[model samples]
Target: MLRNWQEVLDLLAIIVKIPAALIMKVEPPHIKVCLSSHSHGNPYEEHEMAALGTGLYCETVMATRAPLLVPDALADPHWRNNPDVKLGMISHLGLPLVWPDQNIFGTICVLDGRENHYSPPFLQLIQQFRGIVERVLKQIYYDEVRVHEEAAIRADDAKRVRLEFAAIRDREQKALQAIKESKQRWHFALEGAGDGVWDWDMARNTVFYSKRCLELPGFPEHKSLVDFAEWERCPHPDDAATVLAEVQACLDGCIPAFANEHRVQAGGGWKWLLTRGMVVGRDDAGRPLRMTGTYSDPQAGRSRLAGTERPPGRTGRHADGGIAARHGTDRRHGKDGLAGPPGGRCGPRIEHAGGQYHPVIVEPEGSHRGYLRARRRQAADGQRAGRIPAQRQGRL
Candidate 1:
C-alpha cells in the first residue's frame, strides 16, 4: 500500500516540473517526509524530519488546514527567512490532508528551486491525489476498530467457560463430603452393636473385615483385607459346601437374606459362628456388587437347650442322639453321679485323641465307659456328626 503512494508522489513531481514532491506526516514537535519523490535533483529524502513550527512550507498548510503557495520565499518578507531557502526551494504548492474525523493528518506538496507560480492544472492534480490518500486512511481506521471488537468478544466467552467449570467443581466436592460423612456414621452404628462386620466387594472379589471380625476367627486385629480364595479357606471342610451354597443363593437373589451357622477353624479347635448378611448394593442389572454382614456368637442362646435336671432315678438318654449326645452329659446316672449343670459336670471330660480334643459325653449306668470307647472309635474312623459344634459345651 505504501509502495503505491510512493509512486503517486514520484509522478506528481515529474508532471509539476518540480525538484521535490513529498507526503509529510506530523508527529508532535517534528514533521517527517513519509514518502519522497524519486525524481532526479529532488533534495528531500523519505523519512527525513524537521522541527515543526519552524516556518516550513508543509507546517503552514497543516496549521491553517488549507492549501499554501509561495511564489518566492526570498521576496515575501513573511517567508524570506524560512528554512526552505537553505534547500534552494523558493517556490511551493501544498494541500493539507485530513482524516474522515476532520483531524489533520499531514500535507501533500511540491517544491521548486526556481521562482515561478504553480499552474492551476498542477494545483488541481495534487488536490485529486489528496482525496485518494484520505480515503485509504478511512479504511485503515475502521479495520483497527473491527479487530479490537472481535478480541473483546472472545475474551467474554472465555471468562464464561471458566466460571461454569468452577461451579461444577464446587458441586462435586460437596457431594463427596456428604458420602464420607454417611459412611462414618454407618460404621459407628455397626461397631456399637457388638457385631463383627465384614464387607465384600464383588467386583474386586475382595473382602474387608473389621477389627472385631478378624478377632472372631483368631486373626490379628490389624488384618483387614483378604482375597476371595483366602476367605474360602476359613470355613471347616465339613461345613464349607453348605455355607457356600447358602451364600450363593442370597447373592443370586434367590433368598432375601443369608443366615447360616457354620464351623470355622480357629486356634482352639473349631468354633461355631452364626453369620447373617444380605446384598446391600447391586448394579443396574440387579446383580450384586457389594455385600455386608455380621458374625455373632449363637452359643449364648443355645446353652438353655442343654436340658433341665432329670429325676432321681431317671437318666436323659437316647440311642440316636447324634453329635448332641456326644456334647451333652447325663448328670443323674453317670459314674460320678454328680447332679449339676450339664456343661459344668461334663465339660472337663474332653479327651485328647487323634490329634484333636474329643468331647466325651457321660451316658447312663453301664454305658458311661462304653460311650467313651465308642467316641474314641468314631474319632479313629474319621466320623463327624452333623449338629453344630460347641465352643463351650456347658454354656451352649
Candidate 2:
C-alpha cells in the first residue's frame, strides 16, 4: 500500500518541480512514508522498501508526525544532504495529509530549486493537494488498499542523518590534512634562513631554543640549555649588564621593541650576533604571553669582508713588545672562558685588522653611533682576560 502511494507522490513531485517529498502514514509501529518522490522511481518491493532504510529525511518528519518545512537545505542542520539537496534543490514544504478520522495518511510536499519559507502560493497549493491526497487515502482505506507509510518515513529519516554524518567526517579529515601540510611548510621556511630562533613560554618558564640558536651562541654541543639565568652565566660580564638592560627594557615595554646588534664573547672570542625581535602579538587583556626572537652570527661577514674591499693584509708590529698575533680563535663557554685552538694565537689585534670596534667595526662608513667596543681574549698563559683592547694597537 505504501509502495503505491509513493509511486504517485514521486511522479507528482517531479512533474511539479517539487523536490523529493513524502506521503507518510502516521500509525503505530510505523509512522512512515507510504510514498516518496524518490521511492516513486523505484519498485516498492519488500526488499526495496527495507533497502531504502533511512535514505531520506522526510520519514523523519513522518516519524515525528508533524508538518515540517525545511526552507534551506544548506542552512538547515537537518536535511543538509537530502538527495534533493545534493541535486541542488533547496526549498521544502511538507503538510501532513490526514484521513477523515484525523489519522495522518501522508504528507503533500513541494520542493524548489531556491529556498523559501513557505509562501502564500505554496501554502495554497499544499492545502489543495493535501485535501485531495487525504480524501483519496480515506477512500482507499475503505477499499482496504491503504498501505502503512510510517515505516517508510522513519527509514528515510535515518538515512539522511547517516549521510550528513559522513559529510561532516569527510570535511574534518580534509581540514586536518591541510593543517599538517601547512606546519611542514612553515618549518621548512624557518630553517632555511640560517637564523637561530627561540621561544620563551612565559607561563611555563620554559625555554625553547632551536639547535640553530645554540649554534649561533657558539654552544651547539650544549647538553642542556635554560633561560636567561643559564645564558647570562656565559655572557661576557661587561656585555652581560648592557645586554640584559636592553632586553629588560624591551620586554618591559619601556622601549620600542626592536632588533640590536651586540657582540657576545663565546669561547673566549667575541662573535658578532644580530638579535632581532618584537612584541608583535599579545594574548587577551593584552598581557605578554610569549616572546620569540632570532639571532644570526655575522662573523662570516668579517672573513668575507677582509677578502673583498680592503687594503692588502698588512702585518703590524707593535712598538711595545711581543708579536701582536692577529690570527686568533676564542671559544669561551663562560665556565672555561676562552680556550685557544692548540696554537697560542691571541685575540684579534687592532693594528692588523685596522679599525675601531665602535659603530661598524669593519665598515668604516657605518654609522659611528654610540656603540662600545669590548674585546675578550686569551693571554699567552691561556687565562681568559676581558679588556677594552688598547686603542687599535693590535691587528686582525
Distance from true location, Cα of 244 in model 1, Å:
7.4
Runs of candidate 1 with Cα error greater than 4 angstroms are 53-55, 100-104, 189-396
- In lDDT terms, which candidate is top? 1
Q: Which residue runs of candidate 2 sit more than 4 Å off their true CA positions?
A: 1-191, 220-225, 265-270, 301-396
Instruction: Report the lDDT tens digits of candidate 2 across residue range 5-80.
Output: 5666666665555555555454444444355567333222222232223435456555576767777888977778
lDDT digits (tens) for residues 1-396 of candidate 1 = 799999998898788778899999888889899999999888888889899878898888998999999999989999888898888889898899887778788999888888979888878888889989988988887787788888888888888888988888888888888888887777678666656889888778788998777766667765689876677667654344345544665666766776666556666466666677778988787777788888766553321111233223222212232122343533322334433222332212322344322323333322333344445567798886233222332211
Look at candidate 2 and tell me the lDDT of residue 325: 17
Model 2 root mean square deviation, Cα atoms: 23.1
lDDT of 1 at 294: 81
